[model samples]
Target: MKQDTPTPLQEADDSGFAVRVTQSAKSVAAKVLPVSSGATALLFGVVMFLVTFGMVMVFAASSVDSVRSEQNILSVVFRQGLFTFFGIPLMLIAARVKEGFYRRVAVWGVLLGIALQCLVFTPLGDEYGGNRNWIRFGDFVSIQPSEFVKLALAVWIGFVLSRKGGRVREFIPAWIPVAPVAILAIGLVMLGRDFGTVVIMVALVFGAMFIAGVKIRHLLAPLIVVSVVAVPIVLSSPSRVRRIQHFFDGCTEAEYYAGCWQQLHGTWAMSGGGVLGVGLGNSRAKWNWLPEADSDYIFAIIAEELGMIGAITVLLLYAVMTYAFIRIIREAQSPFTKIVTGAVMVWIVGQAFVNIAVVLGLLPVLGVPLPLVSAGGSQTLATLLAIGVVLALARSDRQSSQDGEAPEDVRLAVRAEGRA
Candidate 1:
């Protein structure tokens, strides 16, 4: 063996062979491990990009309306930008807070939301588009308080359900603690006559419970009860009933000039964009043809000006964002982090889908603004704050991982993959 010692050429070949094997093993491992480690950075990047993209889209969609109504073409964009400024800092602050701090204050947050929502019934409350949900802070300034309630409900539900812990499998144990407060939140929003928000709030409650591992039967019971109660409420309103009736008509002539006006125009906007949009700021809908161009139906304008590709890109971004939230949920070590992150995922992303479906006539118009992309300060601020909470959860989860106590789910996943 000593006499047959390998030459430099043999040594080089052996080293290269080891390198090839290592690379091959890594490739195989990469294929086996489909999920990333929480992907916190990806979540933040997607959110920031959406916020910036929303400002740009709002500018494009609101230019005509701003010039027509405000006499200043930049007025709407400037207002939204100001909200962006305010929301970003709140988001950063939220990201720095401890998760346990939110848990301890959930009840107070719900009370605050309820108090603000009560203002909708006060003298300062102003009616807009038939929904008496706005409170004016000044002659030109107003806010929709239900927007804040959306996040508050999520936090409260998580705190209450997580308190149940091992007993969460029992319906009464989980349902009784949060039921009264949940009812009060829903009732206050109902008093404002904003059914769109009511639907979202209902979903938000169920989402928190579901994510916290509450009994499914308990979750389903309330969902069914709410649906049953909502039917007559929908049919009782003549305007809502008309919208429902026209929803199935496919925007025909008889209904087009009446209830389906926005529906038809929104459809036309999407069709005009084709595979690639007409080009940014080139949408005809913003010229007064499609209503709520910068709010509920902004998705239509995005499709119209940017085309199908643009629409797909927006959807892909959301999909990625959703995945990141799910990853956080899976990697989270504490019940609070998992519950809050899941609740936020449902709030912002679920609302976006509903808004898009309404614009495309796939669903009856719900009047909910597109999250992050809509030109409303309240929705934008609340949503950014929610994301901040999510980032906070992510920070904690990452720190926990670095300390070698990986979340149980993640550790199990790694162990299983390693065996392969």
Candidate 2:
């Protein structure tokens, strides 16, 4: 049975369909292929590595607690994995979003963040470790609005400073709206009593401003003001005061069992790891010894199981990530990209530093988790989303260069303005 020949209309329709398919394939390739820039690829690889490593660590660290609570041994890690499952796609989707979209939604993003944060005060709010900074939806899910608030604050600050451009040196024009909005964001988190997040947000704002070329003299005044306000706030919390005192003064034998319990145990865990560590999944600290083994104090658990080498490996990964961020920032033609990337760098890397420092007793316990490596769903998702934004910025730079737009030296432009 021979098939009948196609009609002219049918031939025309088939040709059109083939052309459409070709166009679609080319479109997909264009989107997929350009994401392979050295910086973007390095960043994407490093983030995925940390995320996978985090899942392994979270399983190791939370297994004991999970079993003790009579839940499956994989319960905590499974939830973390679920977050990762959702987060990765969100990250990739975010990475493909255009720069103009971020600029257009910058203010609305802040407002949405603020609205979510305010929900923490309502009936849906849940308190954990003394910070009422979470919004819970029944027994299954809890959201930390502060985590996304950090992202919004970074984007908003970047937008504001970039818009100001040369006037970033002038305090009033640069800071009026930016300062109040940032302070409000930070103030909301503070009201939730999460001093750790507050500190990270402050550093994030400062980092963005510095990258946007705000003058040092202008920064100093805000630093003083924050310090002054911070002192009284620290003093008001007895727990905060004890933590500060413990850091400055030695922990007495009695105090060690009291206020310094977590810090002392964390230090012991790190030292116990010696060189190569006790071996993965062999952490003694996770056996009801160290509090927050899978979250804020996860680094100690990392040291205990993987040893100094493992701990250092984690640090090196962050260093590599920082390098990728710097590469993107340096290559970026837009002030907004530089500022956003810098702020995110500070938020992730700076928070990691704070978390590790707390573990090593270099600083008092600040209750901050290691970004992308902790068991917290909110933290992991937020960090991955932020990373996606950086990737988008890097891709934007590459696309700009490919279009033959001469790369502008953002720093040089800022310096020229300063000289003027």
Candidate 3:
């Protein structure tokens, strides 16, 4: 009787019908799309291109320095290559971490960063170039904890200012904690005698506060205070004072070379690069004329070897990356995402511009790197890691927006769509 109720053909047809319905439901579930495609794709492409370009330049710029020092032409290139290899994978992993997790971690993150900074005062600290900010692990490996501190402090400020739904105006409840923490962080870095990094950290804090909706008046008072104090610090040191005095001196003046040796050499390196550049790896300044050719002054080397075209190319890449990151902040589902991305963008772009301008004689030398382009292991890896976090935020924001949900509140939602 049961067998007679339905034939084999009818049963097979019923199974096919069920399969179609299930697939149709899945199709409807997956229909949502991101609000903006330009932000994600364009930014991703630009950053990826810049990283690759940086890797190429690292090989070119560091090769000579390597051969001259270690007698191995590939020594620096090999190390850079290794870091790039690790950095790429690390970036991919960071891109997958939850945005909420990044937000929550800011609390402990800042604390850890401060602790690491304190380590510099301990025996673990190593002095280099008159700055005791570096942490030496061995002959060839070490980390600059101050570099990581910049990112952690930025995130913390963003989180703090954005707390209670972006109400950063309350002086006692809000600004009190942030200002003291920031001052402490800055004071620690200044103790290392790295005014450049301290300036960068201050910039990051201000940028975060700005994005968190803090009033200009509130932020400016501290900025003015820091500047007034920094002037005396700069004046107290003979070399730093001379460097400052000579920066204002005319480029034609004799004191320019004697007093501003690094800046002058950097300018010469850039000017030597005409329309098309001397050629990759052919920098005349790398012959020890331009100091720190591979680090703070890499942009000058780039201009010297690649010309105006190459220099613009690098800047354009940065512009594209910055634009993409800004879009991410705009489309972000929450203030936290916006502030974090903004802080990072300002740090990377701001530092790059300062470094380039200094080399061009438009600004005083700040002793900062060109982000991912500069040939420092800890710096390059840390930068790539931060970029990865940005990418993660972008991806998470895209997903949340498509679902018509807040980035922090998004979760699985299921609904049945039935059709006859």
lDDT tens digits, residues 339-412, model 1?
87888888888898888888878888889998888899999999999988888767766667688775443444
377 Cα displacement, candidate 2 (Å) = 0.8
Index of the highest-lDDT prediction: 2
Backbone collision count in every prediction? Answer: 3, 1, 0
Model 1 compared with the native: what TM-score? 0.86
Q: For model 1, how many clashes?
A: 3
Q: Scored by CA lDDT, what does every candidate get?
A: 0.84, 0.89, 0.77
Instruction: Candidate 1: give the clashing pairs.
Output: 276-307, 277-306, 277-307
How do the predictions measure up, each by TM-score? 0.86, 0.89, 0.85
Q: What is the alpha-carbon lDDT of model 1 when measured against the actual structure?
A: 0.84
Looking at model 3, residue 332 earns an lDDT score of 81
Off by over 4 Å in 2: 1-36, 405-420
Q: Top model by TM-score, which number?
A: 2
Worst 10 residues of 3 by lDDT: 411-420
Q: Cα RMSDs of all predictions? A: 8.8, 7.2, 9.6
